[model samples]
Target: MKRFPAAAALLAAVLLLAGCSASGSSNDAGSSVSNPGTGAVTGDGTTKDSGVVGAPQAGDAAGSVTSGSAAGSTSEVATGQRDVIMTGSMSITAKDPIKATQDAVTITEQAGGRIDSRTENPATENQQASATLTLRIPSGALDRTVTDLKKLGTVNFVSLNASDITQQTQDLDARITALKTSVDRLLTLMQQATTTTDLIAIEGTLSQRQADLESLQSQRNFLSDQVDFSTITLSLYSTGTVAPGAPGDFWTAIGAGWAALVGALGAALVGIGYALPWIALVGVLALIVILIVRMSRRKGKAA
Candidate 1:
């Protein structure tokens, strides 16, 4: 009876030990998974925590973060991703530039683009009708957009430019990441800080870092937009101006020459007619003076 009681107590102890081991394993696994792989998110739904903590002193964090940032930036430069900004300008000639402009607007809209600005000039006696548009088109459809714009009129000039900003973007990203880490460390220090002087200094630094982060993020956003959309300045003009080596018939030239000659002769005749009255007045005065001189001579002879 004594042996049986002892065996039963041993079995109970073994079962309790096994259960405790399983529960501990499960708890540890849950904790590891619940923290998230990236970091902690807050009210703004942004990951603010940099997963860096437990440093002995916060003063040296900035320098360490800068060094790490430099290394990360270098790595980013070597990465395979490419970011480019596309810009272009084109000149097209059409019969009616105003109508072409509308077509261009429609095509751009269909291609998921928008006009940033538009200008139109009505045809004057001295100037041709024209329109200028600044368009923002998706980068993926840049070629297609350009082709569609060409269909609106005869393309006179087309220029496309691309700039690579991958390195700059990567550097900015690395700097932002390092700054976030430094800021996190500063916040932790602020909580553990005991002296008011240290707290004030830390807060001032944190504010500066946050400002810089915000500025960098803005730059990143602008760069991202540039990458997503390409800018194109489209110029549409009526085909009023003739290009060099344009086809011309000899009859047209002869007609122009005949018109010019007729105009020149007409101008000469008008000038002669205007001077006729002045010439007649001088002639009449001469005749009267001659008569008076002759009468005086005759009177002298008689005397």
Candidate 2:
């Protein structure tokens, strides 16, 4: 009876040990399979957190975020850079200075621009007349404006220049905004400016800043105008021509030449006639001086 009880107890202990061993082996095998030869173990026996060597670091969530932001910043800078300033000029020859200038003005207006100034001279001899015009046109229309201007006359000179002024424009804008803020602040503090000395100092500083603001505004307007318009110079000249006479032309030419000579002589005499008073005054002064000296000499001889 004692041997039987001891044998039964041994059998129960062996079964319990076998069951525990089987459960432990099953859990370890599952972990190894999930890791797929990487020797990694996770609480859930899942391979989501484990990766092969050099596997792109699981798609880089934080790095991707930074890269996106940097790309957006670079794109903004490039776009701002594109807002630059460009200049263009053209020279044309026309048959009439006034007509050419008028035509140019019309064209400038049609191109959504205005003429800053126009200079035309018709009284100048040699039939060489010219007009210079400063115009403001949109940058997009610069090329078309030049083409249209060229149609007005023979193109003598054409030039174009482009410069990056984005930085300058931005800086000026910022400065203007700051000056405006300062002006507003000063106005608010006007009641506090009691003492004469303080008042003078404040006024002086305000005046300076106001002047600067005006200057900056003027510059901005000028730049804006330039960006919108192109400058053009037009010159006009007439070709001189002579008419031929019939067979007895030599005699006729001689007679005409003689008449011209007589007329020129008459003009010269008339011009000299207008100068007679000044000429007489100079002569009288000289004679009086000479007579005074001679009379002094005569008086000395008599003594």
Candidate 1: stretches off by over 4 Å:
1-53, 56-80, 241-303
In angstroms, the error of model 2 at 89 is: 3.5
lDDT (tens digit, per residue) of candidate 2 on 140-226: 787787788888867778877787665455444444444454455344333344345444544554565577679868987877666
At residue 264, candidate 1 shows an lDDT of 99
Q: Residue 125: error of model 2 in Å?
A: 7.2
User: TM per model?
Assistant: 0.57, 0.54
Q: In order, what lDDT does every prediction score?
A: 0.68, 0.54
Q: Model 1: clashing residue pairs?
A: none
What is the C-alpha lDDT profile of model 1 across 1-303, one tens digit per residue?
A: 755554443333333323433343233223221122121111111211222233434334433444455555556556855789999999999999999999999999999999999999978644778999999999999999999899997999999999998766765665556546646755775675444554565566567657767886899899999999999999998996653333367887688679879999999999999999999999999999999999999999999
Pick the lDDT winner: 1
lDDT of 1 at 235: 95
